[model samples]
Target chain A: MKEIALHMLDIAENSLDAGATKVELLLELTTGGMLEFSILDNGKGMDDETLKMTSDPFFTSRTTRRVGMGIPLLRQHAELAGGGLKTRSEKGKGTELKAVFVAGHPDIQPLGDIEGCWMMLAAMHNDVNIELRCSTPKGDFEISSELARQELEVEHLNESALRTELKRLIRNNLAAIGFTDGKIDKTILNS
Target chain B: MEKIRSLADLKKIRDENNKGVELRKKGEDADKLVQVKVAMATCGIASGAKETMEFLADSLEKRGVEAVVTQTGCMGYCYAEPTIEVTLPGRDPIVFGNVNVKKADEIIEKYIKGGELVDGIIPVNYETIDSKE
Candidate 1:
C-alpha cells in the first residue's frame, strides 16, 4: 500500500479472483489538483452485506482467512493524502472502486512501479482482457492487452522479451502523458 | 528494441514472429492443465509476492508448461507473506508458504515437473463456508 500502483495491482487481483474476464484500470493523472484512479471489472460483485463491510479490515469474504485489508488500506491511503475512496458494487453485477489522492499533499504516496504493475497484469493473465488508460491534461493514451496481443500475434503475453517490450512501451506512453517515474511532472498542472 | 510508441509500432518489429507457446487447446478448461493461485493481499505484496508471481508466470511459460497463474486473496498466512497454492490436473491443491523466487523455481522443477511434493507445505485441514454442508 506504500505505492498507489501496488493498490491498483491488489484491486485488479481482486477482480480476477472474482472471475472477472474484463478488467479496466483507469488513471486521471491530475484532476482538480488530485490524482484519481479507478479499477472496474465485470466480475461477481458483492452483495449489500459484503459491500457494507468492504472498508472493514477484518471483514473478508475469503474462507481461507478472516482479514482483508485491501479496501481499507486503499481508503486509508487516500484519506492520508486528503482524498477519499468510493466503492460501488451490486450482486452478480460487478465492482467499481475509485480512489483519489491530493496531488500536493505531503503525505501522498508515490505512484510506484506502474510499469511493473501493468506488465504483470497483462503478462500473468493471458485469457483476461485488461486495458490501461491514462488520462492527463495533454491527452489520453490507452493500452489494450487484446490489441497488443493482436498486434504482436502472441497467444500468451507471458513472453519475457515481450514483457520487457510492453513494459518499455507502457513507460514511454505514460511518460508522454506527463506521468513518469512514479510521479506526475509539474508541467501537468500547468497544462 | 526500437521505440514502441504504439501497438502498431510493436507489431512492426515482430511482424514475422508468430507461434511458440500453447496455453491450452480450444474449448478446454485451462485449469485442467496447471493452476497456480498466488496469495496477493497486502502482506503478500509486502513480502515480494509480486516478484514470485512474475517469476512463476515467466518460468512456467519459458519451460513450455501450459499453466494458468492467478492471484488470490489472503489465505490466512500473514506470517508467510508470499504463499502459493498449486493444483495439478485431477489433484488436490497444495499450499506452499514463505516462497521466494528460488523456492518457486524449486517447486516448478521438482513438484510441478517431477510430481514430487516439495518442502514448506502448509497443511490445509480447515473447511470454508462454501464447503460446509
Candidate 2:
C-alpha cells in the first residue's frame, strides 16, 4: 500500500484469488513513453458488472467492509501520475489489469525494490505458478518459479537461502529499472 | 552497467551479493528456516490478512525464529479466510484457517518451533482442476 510494488502485489494477490494457477506479471516501459505494468491471470474472470463496479470505492461484493477501495487507489495513483489503469475480464476465461505511469512524470512514484515484492510473493504463494517479468529502458529480467525449480533441481523456492536467491532476482529487476541502491532491509528479511 | 538479458546474469549478480551473507550454497539442506505463507487475497484481507501477516512478522522477530512471513493469493477456501500454511523442516506443510494473532502465536509456539499441530487445519487438495486443463 505504501509503494507501487505493494499495489502490483495487491492486484497479483487478487489475481491468484481468482483461481489462477499461472499468472503472467509484466512491467515494461511502453512505446508510448509510459511505464506499463500488467498482471494477466488464468483465474475465474469477473463479469462485466463487477469490472464496471470495481472502480467504485463503495462497491464490493465481499461482505467485509462497506467501502471497497483497492482498485480505486490504483486508479487514483495512475491518474495522478498522468496515466490510467484498465481491467478486462470474462466470466470463465481470466483477467488482465494494466496500469500505466507516465514516463518521467513528476507525480509518478518510483518503483520500489522488487526484492521485497518477490520475497513477499515467494514466501506467500508457494503453491501457485507465478511468472514475473520486468523490463526497462536499460535492461530486462524475468523469474519463473516453474523454470527455477526445473533448473535448480528443487521442489519449491520459498524456504531457506533459496529465498535469498529469489530476493537477488528481484533486486536485479529493480536495478534494471534504475533502482540500484535498493536492498532488502536486512531487518525485514531476517524477520 | 551491463545488460541483464537472462536469468544467468541475474544469478551471477545474485551470487555476488551473497558474499555479504553466509549463503548456504545451493545443494545444502535448508532445514531450520521456518516458512510461513500469509493469505493476503481480497477475501483474506477482508478477514484481516494484513494484520495477521504483520503480527507474524513482528512476533517471529521477537522470538528469534528468523522466519519469512509473506502475503499470498487466495487458496479458494473463502470460508477459511486469513488462512496460513506453515512448513517446517522435513514435515508435510500444514494449513490453518481463520488465522489471527492468537492462532499465529499458537502456530509459532506449537507448530513452528514446537512441532505440534493445532486446530483449524485445512487439508490441501493438490488435485483441484485448473481451467487450462
Candidate 3:
C-alpha cells in the first residue's frame, strides 16, 4: 500500500475476517516527529505457531493462495520508515498490531485518504464495531461506530445519511486537529 | 490459525446459519433475486465506492428489499470509478457510474424500488462472462 491509511485498511480487514466484534485503531503523532499506528481487535486470535510466523510473507493460513502479504508488507514499510512493527496475539483472545515510524523519514509514505478508509470499513462491516482515536500535538480526535449508531438512531453504520454525517464529522475533527494539510507537518520532509 | 481446507465445508456451515439471508443458492437462476455488484478496485475505493456500497446495503435492508450485494474488481471504467451493476430479477444488468450516497438513494428509490431507470447509466460497452453464454 502506498499510503499508511491503506495499510491500516488491510489490517482491519484481517481483523474482520477473524470474526472480530470490536476493533480499535489508534494513530498518534507526537511533537517529536514519531508516528504510532496501532490496531487492537477482539477476535479469534492466532495460535503461538501462527503468531510467530505472521511476519513471514510466504506463510498464510488460507487455503486459497500461498502467501499472506499484509503484515509482511507493513513490516517492510515500517522498517523503511525508520521504525518497526510489533504484534501480540493469543488463541481465542484477540490480536494487537502496532507500527511506529518517524514522520520526517524520507521513506515514510503519506497518510493518504483516511476518510475513505473509515467510510468503507464502517459501511461494509456493520456487524463489527470500530473505535478510531488519534492524538496529535493539537489534541485528540475520536470516533466510534457504536456511538455514531446510537446518536443517529440507526441500526447500522451503512445508512446513507448517517454515513455522510460520519464522514463530515471525521473530516471536520481531523481538520481541527491540524490535519488540514493532510499530515502533521508538511515541512517535515523538507526539513 | 487453522487452515480453511474445504470451501464446501465452510459453505455448508454458512448455509446452516444463513437460511433466508443467503442471496445465492446452488442451481438457482439469476432472475430469482435482486443482484448488486459494486466496483471495489483501488480506483473505486479512492472514488467512494465503499460509501456507495454501504448505502446500498443499509437502504436495501431497511426497506425490506431482498438483495445480494457483492463486490467486484475494476470493469475497465477508472474514469467512472464507484460504479455499480444492478440486476433486477429477469432483467439485464444496468451499470451506473459515479455513484455516491445520493445517487445510491435514487437507485434504491427510483430504479430498484420503482423499476424506473434513472440517470448515470454508463452504456454497456462490453458483456460480462455470465452474460456471454
Ten contiguous residues with the weakest lDDT in model 3 chain B: B1-10
TM agreement with the true structure for every prediction: 0.79, 0.64, 0.65
lDDT assessment of candidate 1: 0.82
Steric clash pairs (candidate 3):
none
User: How many clashing pairs per prediction, in order?
Assistant: 0, 0, 0
Quote the positional error of residue B108 for candidate 1 in Å: 5.4
What candidate 1 gets wrong by more than 4 Å, as runs, is A47-49, A186-191, B1-5, B19-36, B60-70, B86-94, B102-119, B123-133
Over A7-113, each residue of candidate 3 has an lDDT whose tens digit, in order, gives 77778877887899999988988778889999999999998889989899888665433566778888999999999999999889999999999988889988765
Q: For candidate 3, what is the TM-score?
A: 0.65
Task: Write one digit per residue (lDDT tens) for candidate 1, span A88-135.
Answer: 998788999999988778898888778889888887677888988888
Q: Who is ahead in DockQ, 1 or 3?
A: 1
Q: What RMSD does each model have against the real structure? A: 4.3, 9.3, 11.8
Give the residue spans of candidate 2 off by over 4 A. A181-191, B1-6, B9-133
Better of 2 and 3 by lDDT: 3
Clashing pairs in 1: none
Ranking by lDDT: 1, 3, 2
